[model samples]
Target: MSLASHLDELSRKHSDIERQINAAMLHPSIDALEIANLKRRKLALKDEIEKLKSQPTSH
Candidate 1:
């Protein structure tokens, strides 16, 4: 896949993760440990998306 496509996929995945985190935060029954884990994963995705954005484009 091309760099642009790869970046786009990453962005979409990041958005999905963010949505999951939001849901977890709003769910009263969510376990503390599970919420923490989800938050960590979301932050990691955000960092990766930032890295992808920072890279120079091939085109």
Candidate 2:
């Protein structure tokens, strides 16, 4: 897949993760460890997206 498409997919995933985190937070029986893991994964994805965006494109 092209870089643009890949970026789009990653962006969608990031948004999904954000929604998941929010939903998890609103739950009455929220698991701390689970939320931490989700947050870690989200941060990793964000870092990856930023790194990809910073790289120079070959066109």
Candidate 3:
């Protein structure tokens, strides 16, 4: 897959994770560990997105 497509997929996943985190927060009985795990995954995705953005794209 091309870099652009890969970046788009990552962005979509990051957005999905954000939605999941929000939904989890709204739950009456939130699991702390679950939220922490989601947050960690979100951070990792963010780092990857940033790294990809920083790389020079080939024509």
- Candidate topping lDDT: 3
Q: Which scores greater on TM-score, model 2 or model 3?
A: 2
Ranking by lDDT: 3, 2, 1
Cα error, residue 44 of model 1, in Å, equals: 1.2
Tell me, by TM-score, which candidate is best.
2
Each prediction's total of clashing residue pairs, residues at least 3 apart in sequence or on different chains, is: 0, 0, 0
Residues 1-59 of candidate 1: C-alpha lDDT, one tens digit per residue: 87778878877887887788788889899888987887788788778878878988766
**Candidate 1: where are CA atoms >4 Å away?**
57-59
Q: Considering TM-score, which of the candidate structures 1 and 3 is the better prediction for this target?
A: 3
For each of the candidates, the C-alpha root-mean-square deviation to the true structure, in angstroms, is: 1.8, 0.8, 1.1
The whole-model C-alpha lDDT of candidate 2 against the native structure comes to 0.92
**Candidate 3, superposed: residue stretches over 4 Å from native:** none
lDDT score, candidate 3: 0.93
Instruction: Give per-residue CA lDDT, model 2, range 1-59, as digits (tens).
Output: 98889999988999999999999999969998999999998999899999999999886
TM-score of 2: 0.93
